[model samples]
Target: MKKYILDLPEFILVALSAYWFLENYIGTNHFNPYAFIVFAMLLLQIYFKNKYVGFLLAWFISLFSLYMVLAVISEFRDFPTLISEGALKLLAFGLGFCFLAMGSAVLMFYKYFPKVFPARF
Candidate 1:
């Protein structure tokens, strides 16, 4: 298995980016979790077991995370009382935990299962 920690920064950034973009553009209070899951699957299928693919996912995740943080910050500043603290906390927890788990799994596979993440042309 590859070390998913390797993709931490990217995951945070991408996930946050997606979160913020969605919030700002859609004016929504929650992230559509299904959308990110679909993205994850697409990345896996399209990349076809390349290390660079991992990097790409990481970058995307980072963008997403950046968005999320921005949204929370903006909301907190404008209407702290209007914001549901639980929602923010839950989103952070879910995003951080799940993304790390998925990223780590990918890294672990590459680390141990070289056949899966084979050196390529």
Candidate 2:
């Protein structure tokens, strides 16, 4: 369905972000199964009918995206040059994605979702 184009990839990114954040932030020594659980559930979240859950999920995505923006900058700040081709490309991609994810989250907050999944919570 047309809706999948937006929702599928959006949640996929959410899952990846969640997984990466947990893995990196918490460290391997303190590994836990929660991240994997989150990744799996997010992948299945193609549709959301509950206003509260949708709002919460979108909020999470937006916050995580902001965190990603900071992470990207901090992770790359020590590079030899900020404008090197690779670095520039990465920065652009990172910013663009965060902008898009946050925008989608806003849309969800405003009840503009495309009905990508069944009722959840």
Q: Give me the candidate number with maximum lDDT.
A: 2
lDDT of 2 by residue, 1-121 (tens): 6666545544655656675658665776565565565555455455444555665677787897789789888866867988798888888887876777777677655553545444687
Query: Using Cα atoms with residue i matched to residue i, what is each candidate's TM-score against the true structure?
Result: 0.38, 0.58
lDDT score for residue 75 of model 2: 61
What root-mean-square deviation over C-alphas does model 2 reach? 6.4
Please write out the lDDT profile of model 1 over residues 1-121, one tens digit for every residue: 2445544434554564456457654785656665666456444633464555555554454455466656655645564454578666755675565565455445534433454356787
User: Model 2: runs farther than 4 Å from truth?
Assistant: 1-45, 112-121
Cα lDDT of candidate 2 equals 0.65
Q: How well does candidate 1 match the true structure in TM-score terms?
A: 0.38
